[model samples]
Target: MKLTLKKGPLYLQVQEILKKRIISGVYPKHSLIPSELELKEEFDVSLITIRRAVEELSKQGYVEKKSGVGTTVLDNHAISKLSKGQRFSEYLIKEGYHLKKEFASLSTINLHEHAADLVEHFGDECYCVERLYTLEEKPYIHFKHYISKEVTLPENTDLLLDSLYEIFFQQGITFNRFKDEFGTEIPDPSIAEILEIEQQPLLQRIRYSFDINEKLIEYSVAYYNTAIHKYVVNFDV
Candidate 1:
């Protein structure tokens, strides 16, 4: 995979990608990740860069280095959650469902359309991206993400290739907290057409993500196709 040069340090970008792999169970827990030389070949970076990335993961408790056995993954899902429980994607993935997000468009837009909804929580100007998530190759959710004006989005961002949060991280914006509101609504005709839904009530979720300073970083509204799969939330005791 090619690393973006401007996403902080090259090693950090490699570390974040490796972190995602670990979280997704690609490099399963208790398994050894690739050797520094192997990772160097995979990422087309120097051995020092791979070593630093691995060392950073090790320091974060995701892995541990052995004298000769190389680094081994210690945990698979150590990443923080948006709320108190697992997200719908995590729940579905755990249930053996394949989920994919298809990118439709990414551009700047005014929040005038959402003026009657949650527009008060965000600035009038934002970077909007329209995405549709699929489950088992079937339309499942219509997602609209409105990123804060504080982030300067690069033209090369591919929402289908990377998670939107990860893309935001590339711009040096990190979401530390999120507020979610759930409701039922009849989505707009365009969103209805994208999700292949009739003009009927559907499960809706509004999320506002914030940085450590409590400033809004992202605002998103998602409409789920409840006829295909109901939204699930887990509670861990």
Candidate 2:
């Protein structure tokens, strides 16, 4: 492995190098990390620096250490890397699957307590919409969108089945995404019913926030079924 510390702290730089290799499959999941003494020489850094780097990697969910068993890379099952400016809808279209949309509901209501804070960030009056997207008749993604009630959308909104952002852009409302978070978990009972998934670990949840005209105006949550699809993201280290 090539190691250089021309920029950033030596230990942080070391951590990035190791993290890149691990995520890129240079070091596969559950594979053992090299001995500290070996890494010390490889990076041409002091042993303390090597140890600190390893510790940092552990904190970031990259690796784990065991007594008398050395360090092991963790399995990163969920897609965690992303290209700088790739759009999920564009990626899906490139895969040759036709995305279809089924609108569930759209209404103005008081924000549920769980989503109150995010709703407040947009505005006191929030409009919510629910939708399900399918690829070639196979149910794919379930999404709920919350936006400022002040911004009037179509009386009957149609999100083009393939791209919600496209509609926003066409309406001259450029979405400003503030947060994007994803994780793996068992499907909620209601979600499981909707997705027809019958077991645990069948779901991937994504929550994001966006601003309109420099004002926070949208918060969205999407649920994806992992049993039928896998996510892949490519990023430059």
Candidate 3:
């Protein structure tokens, strides 16, 4: 069947198509998926694109690849915990958690000197949005986002109800790639109180997102309460 690809990266489009097929049982559990050459012909995309899409599927645990044999689908339930390309908030909601986001603060700020190199192109100032997420009515995640001033956030947008990424997309901002750095730290008193923790450790993640033209668009830091929820990362061989 011919696939109508979307506007983003071809591999991502193909990945979504294949994932939908797997979830819909079009490619049943343990059944072999279309070979690379066959999928290439079907989608009229390059071999590299086809391979990347399949590689993503394998990494997400939807399928497994064997050198001699073709790719085989896995039980969807077995891979429900797999998180490959979703935002952390999206992952939590997909996992059946009741999530609520509250805007702790939203204002413009001078970029810190230490992180200045990360968004040097955006100059000295940027808009900052701080958010707190409650899962099951308890503090679960805290996010601090720094966005380039050049990228306009909608004045009519509601940060509490709408997704930041969705707002960016609506404003014609398309992400090309992202770089993430992970670390662990003990929260300071101020942050600890906001997170409702006394002395527990927090999983820290800093990510920089760039657009298709290679312009830095956003820098964000997230602190996760690992005692209540776990972070899972999947890597393919």
Candidate 4:
């Protein structure tokens, strides 16, 4: 309950300590947090410090405070921690590749020809978020994501820096396996600039579908710079 800020700034240290405890199941989801007065005594910190730490957690959707109810822990298994199953980026990072991203667009749009079928599955309600991945600032891949309107996205968030999977996870969505298809192609001018490859550098086109709660909720298409990224998927038996 009490922590000494010995390694980092006081607020960040407080944030991490509380976050670890919450993640460790010390506070289960929907469980009310200790009152502000209780936490002040627990951490021996000023009210201002405790307030700042709690605010940080709130921004990440880890905790909520109601008018009469004390702060409560939000279910966040999907956002804060990666599931036992790995993501493609996680797999790449484990292979020692540096990863970064630049956002291009995140908005709602009418379904287009190529995306029409996908849109129908989601009941014609969709949000498109686009971003370009990079390695140390050089454009390496372009990602376009489509999500159902059932998932509420925070307004004006930067997709390049934020993880879409994490966003959906916090909304109580999870993916087991869907469908994926990949091939090589020449990039259109727009995708070319977004990904920052040569005029034509053997673009790797990948389209993936996600299964959420036995419903197909998302579809995405990505273009990767062949020279910089080696997209690989392994199957066990």
Specify the highest-lDDT model's number: 1
The C-alpha stretches of model 1 lying farther than 4 A from their native spots are 1-79, 112-123
**Which 10 residues in a row give candidate 1 its minimum summed lDDT?**
76-85
- How large is the C-alpha RMSD of every model relative to the true structure? 8.2, 12.8, 7.0, 13.2
How many residue pairs clash (N, CA or C atoms closer than 3 angstroms) in each of the candidate models, in the order given?
0, 0, 0, 0
Summarize candidate 3's per-residue lDDT along 1-237 as a digit string, tens digits: 555545678887787678767766789999999899999998898999999988877866678899999999974432232244454566678789898875557677876653566556678788877788888889988888888888777554365346666566546665556778999977667778889899677899888887757887888888889888888653334
Q: Which digits, one per residue and each the tens of the lDDT, describe model 1 over residues 4-58?
A: 7876688977887887788768999999998888889888999899989888777
Candidate 3 vs. true structure, TM-score: 0.60
Model 4 stretches astray by more than 4 angstroms: 1-87, 112-114, 198-207, 233-237
- Better candidate by TM-score, 1 or 2: 1
TM-score top scorer: 1
Model 1, residue 158: C-alpha shift (Å): 3.2
- lDDT for each candidate structure: 0.77, 0.66, 0.75, 0.69
- Model 3: which ten-residue window has the lowest total lDDT? 75-84
Error of 1 at 55 (Å): 22
lDDT of each residue in 166-197, candidate 4, tens digit only:
66655656553456667777777888866655
Q: What TM-score against the true fold does each predicted structure earn?
A: 0.63, 0.54, 0.60, 0.57
By TM-score, the candidates rank as 1, 3, 4, 2
Q: How far does residue 124 in candidate 1 sit from its true spot (Å)?
A: 4.0
